[model samples]
Target: MRTYLDYNATAPLRPEARAAMIAAMDVVGNPSSVHAEGRAALGIVQTARARVAAAVGCQEAEVVFTSGATEAAGVLDGFGDVQVAPTAHDALWAHHRRSEKGASIYAMGVANSETGILSDLPKRDEAGWHAPEGTADFLMLDVTQALGRIPFAFSWSGADLAVCSAHKLGGPKGVGALILRRGLDVEPLSLGGGQEMGRRSGTENVIGIAGFGAAVEAAMRDLAEGQWQRVEKLRNILETSLEARANKTIFVGKAESRLPNTSCFITAGWKGETQVMQMDLAGFAISAGSACSSGKVRESRVLRAMGFDASQAASAVRVSLGPETTEDEVLRFVQAWLGKEEKFRARSAA
Candidate 1:
């Protein structure tokens, strides 16, 4: 039987999300129209928007719906001087300005998608300078991986802006949002009939947005019930078992605060790509690094930024579990992986 453990890449859609989307499929009118059917469609959009706001801990008016996180990254495109964390995801890092000028905007992710390492969120100073002042120095959080897996509230994160994707939290893939601090204006990337409070312009994806709301609400419930803590225990068990068998394996961020379900480990001389293939053949799903880079065979930029050499970076693989993952499944994966490790060591000795 195949086991799926690549939640950092994308979560399996939650039943709540599925049901919401199916119900939204019948929304026939355009939300922008003034007709009765249009008002019903608008109601769905507004309800979903409110759900997203509650989950994010932000005012409902601050949430601007977008196609996905990649498009949401456009908030930085208009700025000529910006700094991005070395380990930031490509969506944000792609906007990095390398001209050696001082930055007025900084972009960083609260959690590393590959290693699952958690980072401190920005805090406002006494002068309220934490929020960007007229495109001046400020912080933007990429909350994609951290939103559902951990406890975070944009209302108090001290960040000027944040971006997240619905799929990362078991919602439909095509919808996402940009959380803008109240009273901070940003030029719209796509200009048309002023929707999303005139911050984003486009016909709403009714089905996807409904799914996103349902998923976020469900994720919030799981967090309140301590479901992630159980996942953490299983992850620790998996790591402990692997360490006993593969003495040379390096578990990244083992001592650091991290997402409960993620484990990134490096086995020198054993390519991560190869391990992923081997594990896939052994009936498990995992990843070498971020899922965004498809058909590319390069060392992980995230690890390299953290001072790992090319060899170590290329040798890393990530295993991320879901709330539904059972201890038995993780143990089975551990056995299959250790078997491959032994064979790889023997081949190197030979």
Candidate 2:
């Protein structure tokens, strides 16, 4: 049987989410229409918005639905001075603009997607910008990878805006949200009917939003029940088992605050792409790094930013678990990796 373990890329769709989406398919009305059918669609959108707001610890009005995290970050496009964290995702990175004057807006990911390294939201003073009117000092945050995997609250995060994708939390892939603190405003990314309170315009994706809401509800329940703790234990087990046999392997962010389910490790001289292919052939799916790079496996920029040399950077493979992962799967992956390690060692010796 095939074992899928690439959660950092995208999670398997949750059954609750699937059912919600299927149910939403029957709601045949545009959210913007004023007719009864349209109003029904509008109600569905509002319900999903409230669910997302609940999960994010923000007000429903603060949440603006978007195509996904990439489009959610479009609010950043209207900003003038932007400073991106070194480890931020490419979407956030694309908005970076260096200015002679200090930056007023900063973009960052709450956690590093590739390495699972957690980053605390910087305070206003630390960011070198004062919160004018107690709002808009801090800019956007990418919560795509951290949303379901960690305890994060946009209401307390200090950032004025946060972007989250649905697929990261076992929802439909196309829908996501931008959480905007009240009283803060930005130019509309797409201007038309102003469906998302004049922030995002156009008809809503009812089915995807329904799925996202259902997935967020499930994720919140799992978090409250401490289900991720079990996944954390599995991650540790995989690391411990691998470390025992692969003495030369280096586990990234092992001693730091990271996502509990993620383990990024490097075995020098063995390219991550090769390991991923071999593991895939062995019925286990993993990733060389972020799945966002158009499937091109390259040296991890996050590793290089953290001062890893090119060799080690290029050799990192990430195994991210989920609530559904079991002990058997983790151990099986460890065994397969160990076998691969031995072959690499033998070849190097020969």
Candidate 3:
């Protein structure tokens, strides 16, 4: 069987989550209505809200369900001066970049996507005249990649808004949540028949929501029980295996903490796309980086912003692990890489 290691993209639905979702699908009603059926659906939504809130260590009232993280980010970006990480999901960057004149906006550079260097958070003393203290009108964190698989304690980060996607943590797709600090003014993306406290309007996707909650709960349970350590070991195996193959190979984001399951690296003299295609043919599923912009020949903005030469940035590929990943699979991947590296070096020599 082919090993699956692209958890950063999306995870397979959990069995318990699947069953909960199936049960939820049977209850059909518009949550906006005051009738019995509607109230039942509303109950599911509230329960999910509490569960998700619990997962993220926030209040139930703070969780605003949305179509997904992209929309969630859009909702938060509507509020104030938007500052986005250069390596953040494109949705957040695009929204901030498109703001009108007089729009409070600033782009913070992160470590290169190809190099995996974490940028230091801006300091108060360094805020300069251009960006005064508390100048961040609204800070929306795209914690999609950092959640579930890593240690992320954002409660003290002072971020006004944050987005999390269910599918990223093995929950059902089509469901996500926006976590806002109490009393932030945000206009609803969908207004009319008010639902979700007038923030999101529509009949709640009960099944998806339930599944999302289950996934969050599962991830939290694993975190408490130390599953993260096991996963980290597997990831290290992959990292060491890759590093052993060639001297020119470079690992990205080595300076700062990163998700335990993710590894971004470049093979000397080999194009990322070529390696990706070859790996796919070898029955391995990896990424050239960011499912949001896979297959595009454009230079990675995250890499350029982090200061990598164009070629190094262009040749990076990311290998992310899932709960199901095995050491054997990682070994096989490294063996394949060694073969590919030899061929690539031979061709360059000619």
Candidate 4:
């Protein structure tokens, strides 16, 4: 049986989301229409907005649905200069780097997609002139990777704007949201018959929105039940098992607070891509850094920012678990990975 240890890339769709999407397929009116059918469609969107707001601990009016986190991050493009942590997701980092100098906006991720490192965002009062508490625009947090996996709230995140993808939290792909504090606004990226309260324009994705709502509800239930704690234990077991056999391996972010299901480790001599292929052939799914950068062969900028050399950064692989991941699956992956590591060691010695 193949074991899937790459949940960070994208989590499997939840049954609740699937069911919601299926039900939404039967709705036949555009949310913009004023007719009864249209009203029904609009109701679906509003309910989803409420659910998403509840999930992120924000007012429903503050949520603006978008195509995905990438498009959601575009809402920050109109801001003046933006400073970003190297650990941010590519979407946010790309826009941040393009902004003018003397950054007034601090944009970064709450949790790194590759290393799973959690960031301690500066408090509103402690942050300088452009603090979130002030009238000027301040922080933009990319909470895509942290949403369902950890507790988060737009009200308490000390960010003027926050972006996240539904797919990251067991909802359907191609749908996300941008959360803004009341009274703050962004220039619309899409211009159309005004939708998403004119913050994001275009027809609301009724089906996707419904699924997102269902997924958030389901994820919250899992969190409340403490299912992730079990996954965390399994993650520890995998790391401990591998560390006992591979003394030279370096575990990234091991000393820091990270997502419960993620582990990033490096073996200086072995390329991460090679290990990914080896693991795939061994009936396991893994990744060499962010899924967005998997096709490229380069060092991780996140690791480099943490002061690792190019070689060490290039040697990292990430294993992310999900609530469904089992101990047997993790143990099997450990054994297969150890066998491959042993072979690489032998070759290096020879």
Cα lDDT of candidate 1 equals 0.88
Tell me the spans in candidate 2 whose CA falls farther than 4 Å from its real position. 100-103, 126-136
Top-lDDT candidate index: 1
**lDDT of the candidates, in the order given:** 0.88, 0.87, 0.71, 0.85
Q: Estimate, for each residue in 8-58, the C-alpha lDDT of model 4 and write its tens digit.
A: 888999999999999999999999999999999999999999998998889
Model 3 per-residue lDDT tens digits across residues 147-261: 6665554465455567888998889888898887788777787887777888888767888998888888888777778887788798788887767767788887754676677
Runs of candidate 3 exceeding 4 Å displacement: 98-134, 294-297
| Cand. 3 Cα-lDDT | 0.71
Structural similarity to truth (TM-score) of each candidate: 0.95, 0.95, 0.89, 0.95
Candidate 3, after superposition: displacement of residue 94 in Å? 0.8
Cα displacement (angstroms), candidate 4, residue 95, comes to 0.8
Q: Distance (Å) between predicted and true CA of 131, model 2?
A: 13
State the displacement of the C-alpha of residue 323, model 1, in Å, after optimal TM-score superposition. Answer: 0.7
Q: Which ten residues in a row have the lowest lDDT in candidate 3?
A: 124-133
Model 4: residues with Cα > 4 Å off, grouped in runs = 98-103, 126-137
lDDT of 1 by residue, 100-215 (tens): 35446778899999999998654556543342223336678899999878989997777878999999889989899999999986778688988888888889998899899999
